[model samples]
Target: MDEGWDTVEVPARGSDFLQLAVADVPAGGKAEWLAGRLRQAIADGRLAVGSRLPPTRVLAAELRVSRGVVTEAYRRLAEDGQVAGRRRGGTVVVAVPFTTTPPPVPDGGSGEGGVPGTGGPGGRGAQGGNEAGGAGSVRDAGSMGAAGSADVAGGLGWPGDPGDLTGPSPRERVGGPGGPYVGQGAGGPGRPYAGRRVDRPAVPRAGQGTPRPPGPYPGQGAAEDGQPYAGEGGGPGGLFGGEPGVEVFDALRAAPAAVDFTPGRPDLTTFPRAAWLRAERTVLAELSAGQLGYGDPRGAPRLRRAVADWLARVRGVRVEPDAVLIVAGTAQALTLLHPVLRADGVDAVAVEEPGSLGARQHLRNGGLATPPVPVDEEGVRVDALRATGARAVLLTPAHQFPTGVVTSGERRRELLEWARDGGLILEDDYDAEHRYDRPPVPALRALLADRVCYLGSVSKLLAPALRIGWLVAPARYRAALVDAKRFNDLGNAVLPQLVLARLMESGELERHLRLVRGRHRRRRDAMIAALAGHLPGARVHGAAAGLHLTVTYASEVPDTEFAAAALAHGVKCQPLSWHRQSPGPPGLVLGYAATPPGVIAEGVALLGRALRELT
Candidate 1:
């Protein structure tokens, strides 16, 4: 791990933020050098007690060091009890190691004198404004929200002062109480500098903000004119009642709720920031000048090959690297494919009665009709597909969205036979990788390659903001799909493709998957138990797999009314009717992945309260 610091260049790269240079060290191991400098700074009151350290990735990038080196240095500091990771909050100083004397600050030092409201020398914290700890040596977390502070400055003799792991943590000193401190753990993958408690107050995470009056947000419910808003009667409009529209999704997002259960989002707190930075750094460090120009329309070869290999190993889908097409997520995949399908004389794509509304919209936007096909317990009723008379069908076969039913083996064969009858299959294997209770179901594309256009994305596993996905089309449509992608955006940004390819190949992504599966499983169990206790007659669906579970109850009340009522009781979720083209039974899709088990139970209880009041 030693980078031969002995021969390292003088006046080595320094960060204006940290104001620490690699040249400041005594010329040895990179991690040791950085750790020693930070330790000395903390001990000397230069990196004062509560002033936060710069995020690992930010500092590493500025200093031109590998992310691993910075992580290693942070790990050592954590071991010495000098710092600890806060969930949703970055690593911060938990204790200052014993020092012999207070060292004088040099002429120019970025590490010295900055604490929130302290006006030390810098008059600002490391992150600036009030994000840093209290007046001088500790932050009054009350002002910052949720994450109350530990007054380490008051007593250096606190129970867990650095080296004593058996003692209570600093969080307990401020009233959080004794519990496991999983820094970089499954409970939540602590990103370096995830921010100080509130990512932003406007968002209002599960437990972050102060208690709100239990009711629908101001913008929701019947208007002042009061004509049942959208004729659904006495419930939230836009997203929660009547017909849902694309613009309503944004309104649903901006609306306030104490606990949110919107389906299809992963536990974003578990994102592997360190792994991503490592891959990104390596890709950039070795990138070629030629690779800097616009990339191949079908996506970079590196990512395509990685996807190919990854699919073969994980999903039982064998693919040649040349046949793979990188995309900007499943949305783009649908966007590019619709026109190609239209060009191929396919005018309508049949979707499951309870399917992804978003995908249906994309197909409709491309001037393709979306006919409805009913889905039974077995899966999308293939018999119904022939009734619709549509030549193409989009299916979430591996794990059906909102419903979580894996296509039965018989259903798969039926679909394969259907595909062979000159019908095209559009497979969205989005949640296939996150199954907990069942074995992997081979993608429909794997069974009948020529007849199926496969689509997959990391939106459910990684962050959706990445907007990266993969597609595989049969030989006939490959060129046309590539053309569509080329004209769409000249392919996704090449740098992210290379970085994602790096994550896929390095096995880090799989490791991340394993950690999150365990976390999600626990949360799912919590939701299940909460449903049983809170809602007596509720029936849970899709419990065997996927990020969300659907709950249907025997009642005449519309699901949207239940959803609007749930919002009034401090929970947010999607009404099952939103995904249906033809109405049937009422249900609510509840996502368990995005919340911890305790919060999941609370949110479900809130939903139950809302539902009970309605029914």
Candidate 2:
């Protein structure tokens, strides 16, 4: 009788969706118990950004409570701006409680960590902090979705009027008299808030606030998917070898420079906000129920179709929509292609010696080898590529990455012949739309669609925060790439795709392109003129078209150190060494589109001063 088990399990309650502990609540506090549990879940990170909660009815059924109780709880959280209910998308988390560890106590201040009675930051007492009138941080949050209107005060559905922070707390308002269950009156089956009357602060109407114009999301920059631009600390020597992807942006953002010439940036301030908002409203109004769910990994069908048409009309690349596979951006395209390329008997990819360091890193990280090939004025040296014996190669053909050289007619022919010889070409058509001096060139994919895996994105055209791109692969590799995309995050978010499709179909995107091209051209001319006036000895390259100017110095100085010095002088630009795999002359890649004309001139002047001190 003594050799028995020691553990006993309690019988499970309602549905699996309702995560609750009945024993934790007192005898008559079901509504309070549920509301407290939801707040705790949000604070403890059990529910994160973009997470959806169960419907009010379903949750009420699970907890075995009247539907009014669940509705009341959700209304309280909505007032706090922690969650918002989308029409069909359900209730989604919009913001989280801002908690931080208390900083080291300053001298002459109270020795106590936090408030007198409450524990320090993140303590149990502060854990139940209210949204309004609490001694805690309260920062603005980004937009939730199409269901929630813009709230200039803070997050969607948050309490208080614009610029007013002294409003009563949402929880306090709910717990006050005549609230959810405070003065419980037998109001039949519904009407949770229709209990006995008492004086209380009025609740702000849903989505009520002064609306600010829509634009890119907060805390993001041009040419980056939320990562900072390359900084003084990030070059060829910094962590991750200054990979040209988002990491470089992270480093650049960390620098305290006032003037930035970080290349590959379009005029982000000129983003078509009015047009985008119009398109978003149209898409949301027409969105079917199925559109809100998981999407095709190859991207939304509408976007793929729109992309094919846009490329054909604008870039001289004609292809059917079926051949297009939508991706997050060029970075994600490379990621999905790596495994496919490796499995196709290709172990190494040849890159231009002074090629994109980030592209090389992506390939290498995917377990493939990257061999350096040389690049000259004609473009990537075809003869050098043959010497490397690599089966695949990555090239920025429309406009070369740093040098911005257009692939010559002869060079293009030779490369197509090479592709015909069983070699694969990954053509990165980056920033080819902003050309100033010449007519647009036909994409290599347009000429030899079967031989080239073409990649293009809206990063340079609009904002990188959109994270939308397209990939066109040879027929043989298309299926594998599609499968790879399928298993990677279940595809990009659908609403943006649908909205972008609407913009493209409506000709707003084309209008935006025409608008930015003129702005970018003016900025380019300003930078070129500034370079001539400021640094006469510095030779500028790639000025014909593209967003940046490359200046090569004949001195044998390390570009990394030169760039770091320039950063110290309150200017930030990428060193040429960061993009190269082989030894090259000391040079700096200066982006022009981001800065205004005056700032461009000033940034170049700082570069000139930095150069003088280096010598």
Candidate 3:
């Protein structure tokens, strides 16, 4: 005989219920029922080994059962070595099901990411092939870019067809051997401020001369490197504080303020200097004499493997190493795709309104148009995206930039549907690892790798100065993107890639993320408290996770003016207006990761004072 049944109610937000449509389990045997369902899920491959189960409390509350019911159910799985608690990691599956054969990973499956590089079927490649590896190997080794913004958007593919790779590369296409390029890397093309970088050297391959030593690169010690933006008296960014234009990204970074609340920065003060130093030393000690010369354009195999494995463990992305194309940064990843998209007849990329202006600029730099789509509570409005008529769109779904809205499941399904109908997705998962509150969200690439191009970088967790990032593109674009990388600065400095690989493999990067998540959380709490006390009207968004928070208030004042006022009052930030091409609310993207509690409070107080003075 069964007891009275409990009403089945499951919360949608942050749920790990496996979306089972579980209406009712036998009331008397709820735990048993739950365990049985989970056991079958694992056995049949619906639940994978790295998949994380909901926290006992979270599951219990969602199921309208006592926490013990969930606990007991988990315990049953534990007894069978199916799932186990992972402390702060929550509970995760540990063993594969006893099936006749391994279960195929269905698309749009569990968002709970498993351990990276660990679960792929043993012999399969990231794209299940080998041509990508061969393409990545065609590098000019040791080719380095000069410190010039004008040449930053190095001509990827020549003026010929974007798809025509067999034709001359930028080097050959522009001018046969060592054409007229100066102050350039292999085949560098110039952008806005091109004339000023002429003093830098041209780095043709060994055929030109010994590979030029790495100096005068973008971040290196060039006359204009530190002063990214030069205004009256030469500030860190520039003197202009209001909604900055696309051209001033480097200058905005260079601008200085007392209490910088600028978002997207991880606590650089707490970077594991010692750990990095140790890793670099180890890399040097273990390096073969041949390795110090030039290296692979696909990035270090060790790093690619490390990244693939890491993604598998954490992001739930199923890829073999060869599929990974290492680049200077996500910035370069976007640039590399310019020709690829153009070749595919995509001249415009739909962007989320209130999206990263830098991304918009990069796309434009690639000679593509950026159409804006509105982002609501769910995410970039798919309806709006569809209306944009752009075949491709870029997203930061895990934790959207500035806005911080995770794309809801319904929206995700819509995105997949759109992709199936010929649309493309470029996923920039820049800060996915720094999540503090929610459990891991499975990457979209995990669901539809064939239609998505993924970008990730170490600039946040490690240091941006390292200038390292990776790209996982669909097979259609992989070879072209690799060629772009090869010609665009010769595949990032090899030594740093190897060092980062060591860190990822040795668990240093994960440890760093954990340390920073706690610190960033404390700072985030401080900012929220400060906002409540000082700016009563400011409604904070995207506070659930990420290194920053976006706050909106009902103010007629242009957010750019508000930002300028804040900067005048010894604080710095970006106005929400800067990210949105269309008019939106007056808000600020406040970064908390680098600021300490006391400093954050001081900055917010100053912001309040600045706003008061404005009105």
Candidate 4:
């Protein structure tokens, strides 16, 4: 009888059993029954080579059997060389059944070498030997059991089983260059065997599923250069094409490149996790019950005051806290201003010709006409803006984006005069705080507050994920902007606003700014050095400060085509043409802040190689 049969009872909950019919096993054979089932599972491939069996104690509890019963059964499998016990990895299957044909029998009768532990030569009866002793024969017979079917070596593709590859496997169809996993054919390295244990494949680890090919180009399935080719004519697929209103931001975000140099991205790796956590805790500890309610749409009172103080000290712009309104970012500031500007009978806004494409898209999306004005070394040509007849203009004065040209004193006076004469200046001091060699430039808003609606955000100073920014609108439009913000998402989440206020007032943000400046300066220097060595002919721009720099080249090929070629060579960056409405020299907008100096060098070197190949 089974040793534990008297003491252990099957729980009334269920009668769970393995492949073996324990109930049919003759009285004392339960342990032997379990062992027989396990051996068959391993041989027939129900359990793969690396698959772990349940722990002894857990399996014992589940089967309502004594722990010793499961342990003994596991021991039997181990002795047969079918499984092995790893310290913490549990018991794992190690070998498959000896399905391949065995060595031919000796000329004389089979003797000592009778498949170790089996009934010597006689137990090989199925292969021609006679039965020696019934007891030992029965023992050998029980060991092989259902697993013996695998020894026959034929058809039947069981789940998790590595079936006989006698015929073409399904993997053969999706194997070579024609398939997604390009360059790998059936039975080739890194290819999975059909219906086999996934863990056995040399490719990506078990549960990750089929790995996606690098870069998702538009219409094409996969590309050799790892860049997703959307369609012919260099247009991205799926709603991104040569259409005038094509969404560039969405398309670029959808197809992320391996070595990206997309501009305006900050070094997110340096965000102060410890400091933010401490501030968060401090804010929560001092937070009152009343403060949890819907906050002031203009922003939390604490943050507004902090913004006013910080701006006065750093930006040289003085304003009462009441004039400041917290927003999602400069993006939201534009969103809220759209309605306010429209109410003031403004239907069109003039943007710099080679300006931010994303900004232009947002303005157009808000139902405003954006006329392009030419930008020269002095910044947006005041003469060009007057000709366009756009009463309102959006300009990045502190650090002109894409091309970092500061507004000259002559240009500033001209803009102030234009603003005084009923023109609205929407100043985006986007990345002014990151200046390296340039002296601080007072914001256009500081000169003419009533005409210029200034926007600033923590996106470059801190992390964009925070979605925190401050907008100081002219007094006349402040209330209207606040109302627009209130109706759009009931103001930014309150707790983060509070935490940010702590960082700003406590000087933590300034310290962080200092830290990233040094890191960015080094990276900038590295990129400049790399560009000099690799892309000697390429003209680099805006290297003094900011997260990105522009490189213009006097090449025969169009900038967009060149960008596509670079992407094919495992590099990603935006073509300057993407940002400009009016034509100019072809260039690429490359960002270095987020990438380490080493990666920046490698990426630029690749660009040089790709450029040379194209030429």
Whichever of 1 and 2 has more lDDT, that candidate is: 1
For residues 534-605, write the lDDT of model 4, one tens digit per residue.
776555555545788777654565567668777777777887756755435567889988888788879988
Candidate 3 structure lDDT: 0.63
lDDT of 1 by residue, 307-416 (tens): 77676545645566888999989999998887787667787687876788788767766766666665655567887687656788999876777666566656666776
Q: Model 3: runs farther than 4 Å from truth?
A: 1-243
Backbone clashes in model 1, listed as residue pairs: 133-139, 134-138, 134-139
Task: Please list the Cα RMSD from the true structure of every candidate, rounded to 1 decimal place.
Answer: 23.6, 31.5, 16.1, 33.7
Name the candidate that leads on TM-score: 3
Of models 3 and 4, which has the larger lDDT?
Answer: 3
Which residue pairs collide in model 4, if any? Answer: 1-28, 216-228, 217-228, 217-229, 218-229, 218-230, 219-230
Write one digit per residue (lDDT tens) for candidate 3, span 239-318.
44322334455445666678988788988877888988999999999999999877888898989888876776557566
Evaluated at residue 68, the lDDT of candidate 3 is 95
Clash count per candidate: 3, 8, 14, 7
Global fold similarity of model 1 (TM-score): 0.63
Candidate numbers, best TM-score first, in rank order: 3, 1, 4, 2
